[model samples]
Target: MAGAAATGGSARSDTYASARNWLLLPSWAVLCIFVLAPVAMMLVYSFLTKEFRGGVIWEFTLAAYDQFFFDRGLFGDEPARIDWTYILIFWRSIWQAGLATFLALLIGFPTAYFIATRPAQTRTVWVFLITIPYWVNLLIRTVSMKFLLRDQGPLNDFLLATGLIDDPVRIINTNAAVQIGLFYSYLPFMVLPIYASVERYNFALSEAAADLYASKWTTLRRIVIPSVRPGIIAGCILVFVPSLGAFLAPDLLGGAKNFMIGSLIEEQFKGNAGNWPFGAAASMILLTLVLVILMFLARQQARADREATS
Candidate 1:
């Protein structure tokens, strides 16, 4: 009778496992087809050349790559074109992303710290407030900033009325405006991970550090920071990668002159002179850059976790 009971239990376990596997198979298949297949297509497209009159040519060619790497036009002659628009866009995107990430971290750390330290019931309210705006559409939120930042907007009017300035500040149509947009847009992403990390943090670590005569600054540096490194990394990636490829915010809030990789890609896909091949190559480059950064982030997180365990 005992042997028969054990055999029945094993049969149930096998059935459950098989059922779970069946459930996951379709989702995995969808992911492979939609995500991996598109990525594979981009990789292939990156190697092809843009045809003079239209779409990508099937013939193998290195001209697009060569132009991307080595050639540069003279100043005033074709606007001193850099053949490697991909690299230039990459750098600019990263630069903007870096700034956005840094700002988000600075602002989010304090807010998350406060929220996480709150009582359980109060913490729920604070978290809701922080995330509520995120429910709004990204496009609507970005366009709303224009109304607030324009030369004749309320902000400028207030400054003028208060005698803060004789003229309106150039808050709109500049990199600064775009930066503001990026910060506002990505701030929630920065906060969520940090709040999660901070809430899980053991205050005893800092208390022990203090008992060792560590100054407040030193305690934060050595204890608080190291403990929350994972959250910081997650927040940075959340803010940076999105800001890097951000399109709507920059487009709606800043000047046409301030172009980013996302805008450039949009131009290729939908603007006056659509070049699908060039856009595909640019998309592939951006995707590769993201994958590389994520790899580094994963390694860093693993190392931190290992150190924490040790």
Candidate 2:
């Protein structure tokens, strides 16, 4: 009887496992179809030779990647030399993204803290107000921003009328303008994450620190920040990653004077350049870079989880 019962239990377990696998099939299929397939297609295309205008040829070569690293001058027969041009573009993107992330953190932390500290009933209103500006389409908002920041726009005109400056500040077509756009665009990303962390924070701990004679700054630095660090890191990652690939803000605000990585890839495909494989290669490189950042974040998260449980 015991043996028969054990066999029945094992059979039931097998049936359950089979049913679970069948249920998961659709999700896995969608993931492969939507995400993995495109990546695989890009990887394959990055190796193929580019056709004259827009398509790829079946011939396999490392020319796409080689072009990225080595400068082959106008006719493609120049001696291989380290290409600083693309490298500079990448560096500029990184710098702009980093600056944007820093600005977001500086502003977002204070804004999130203020909202988190508000009466619970009113906190929702504050959040709603913050989100109102973002609900508009990004393109429209960016265009509006461009108009507002233009030399003769309301901002400079108001300043000039107030006798703050002799001339209009040239903001509309500068790197500073791009930085401002990135910061404004992604500020909500930074704020939301930090607000979540701050909302769940223990007020009693802060009160206790104060009772122990800790100054506000000291308490914040030692206790509050350490507690909410995960949120800060998450916010930075959210802002920085998107900023790295942002084309619209750079194109509109920076006047397309400089090419961010996104713009460069875009030009390759849509502009007269029309180098499909090179565009695919650039995309793959960007994907690899983002994956590296995600992997590092995952590792740090795992380590933190282990520490918390331990």
Candidate 3:
């Protein structure tokens, strides 16, 4: 009788396993079809050659990547020289994204902390106000920035009327404008994650630090920051990754002068320059960068979890 019961239990377990696998099959199919398939196609396109006309050549070549790193001179006869233009644009994207992330963190942490410390009933109000800008489309928000920053726009007109400056400052089509736009656009992303972290934090630890005669800065640096490090990392990643591929703000605010990786890719895909293979290559590189960053963050989080448990 015991052997018969054990056999029945094993059969039931197998049935459950089969059911679970069947339930998961649809999701797996969607991922393979929608996500993996496109990525695989892009990877294949990146290795191919760009035709003189639109579309890619079937022949596989590394010319797309080669074009990114080297220029064979104007006539294609001289020795290969390193192209600093692409390198400069690449670094510009990195530093600008980093700067925007830093600025967002600077503002987001304080805002999130304030909201987190507020009465639970009123906390929702604060969050609602923070998210009001997101109600509008991103493209509209970016375009609205142009209207505000234009030479004859309200900002310049108000400054002129108030005697702040005799002349309208060149705010549009400049690096400063692009940075400001990026900070404004991605601030909410930073705030929301940090708020999530801060909301769950134990204020008792902060009070304990105060009782121990710790300075405010010391308490924040050592106690609050350590507790919310995951949120800060998440916010930074959320802001930085998107900022790297930002096209609208740079194009609308910075114009031709502030062409970024996103703009470069867009140009290759649809603009006057139609080099799809090179665009695919650039996209692959960006994907690799994002994946590496995510991997590093995952490792750090795992290590922190282990330490905390220990």
Candidate 4:
């Protein structure tokens, strides 16, 4: 009787395990098919050669990556010279993204603090207002900004009419316009995370600090900032990553004059420069970079967690 009971229990456990595996099969299938398959294809393509006219040649070669790192002189026969154009673009993208992240933090922290400090009922209202911009399509918002910033647009006209300047200022199709577009588009991303952190914060600690004769600035720097560091890190990552690969803002606001990595990738795929393999190489490089950053952040967070527990 004891042996029979154990056998029955083991059979039931096996059945349950099988059922769970079956339930999870579809999600695993979708991930493999949709996500892993494309990435695998891109990785394969990155090693191949680019065709003269378009697309890729299946012959595996590192020429695509070589092109990025080395210039084969003017005639493609001399010793390879280092190409700095793509490197410059990469650095510029990093700089612009970093600047945008910093600006977003500067603006988002105060906005989030204000919302978090509001009465409970009104806090929801403020958060809703912050999210309202997302209801509109991003492309539409960026295009609208272009209309407003154009030399003869309402903004310039208003300024000119008010004698702010002698003539219409060139706001559109400039780096400043691109930065403005990026800031406007990603500000909510920055604010929402910080708001989530601030909302959960202990106001009593701040009060206690004040009671202990801590100045507002001292309290903010020593207490509030440290408490919300996670949210700040999250917001910075969210803003910087997307801004690094931003396409529409640079294309529409900055134009051809201010080409970025996103634009370069687009050009490889769709524009006159149809070198799919090269594009894939660039994409893989970007993906690797992002993955490295995420891993570093994950390690740091894990260390922080261990330290806190200890």
TM-score of each candidate?
0.86, 0.95, 0.94, 0.92
lDDT of 4: 0.89
TM-score, structure 4 vs. true: 0.92
Global fold similarity of model 3 (TM-score) = 0.94
The residue ranges of model 2 lying beyond 4 angstroms of the native Cα positions read: 305-310
Please provide, for model 2 over 1-310, each residue's C-alpha lDDT reduced to its tens digit, 9 standing for 90 to 100.
9999999999999999999999999999999999999999999999999988789899999999999888878898988899988878888998999999999999999999999999999999989888888779988998998998999999999999999999999999899999989998999999998998899889898999999999999999988887777788889899999999998889889986767988888778895568988989988988888889889987876675565346
Q: Which stretches of candidate 3 lie over 4 Å from their true place?
A: 306-310
Candidate 1 positional error at 50, Å: 3.5
Candidate 1, residues 27-107, lDDT tens digits: the string is 999999999898888777767877655577886765455455555454424433455556776787789889999999999
Per-prediction backbone clash count: 0, 0, 0, 0
**In model 4, which residue pairs have backbone atoms overlapping below 3 Å?**
none
When summed lDDT is taken over every stretch of 10 residues in candidate 2, the lowest stretch is: 301-310
Q: If ranked by TM-score, best first, what sequence of candidates would result?
A: 2, 3, 4, 1
The TM-score between candidate 2 and the true structure equals 0.95
- lDDT score for candidate 2 against the true structure: 0.90
> For model 1, what is the C-alpha lDDT against the true structure?
0.86
Q: What lDDT tens digits, residue by residue, belong to model 3 across residues 162-235?
A: 99999998999999899989999999999998898899999899999999999999999999988887888889
Q: What is the lDDT of residue 258 in candidate 4?
A: 84
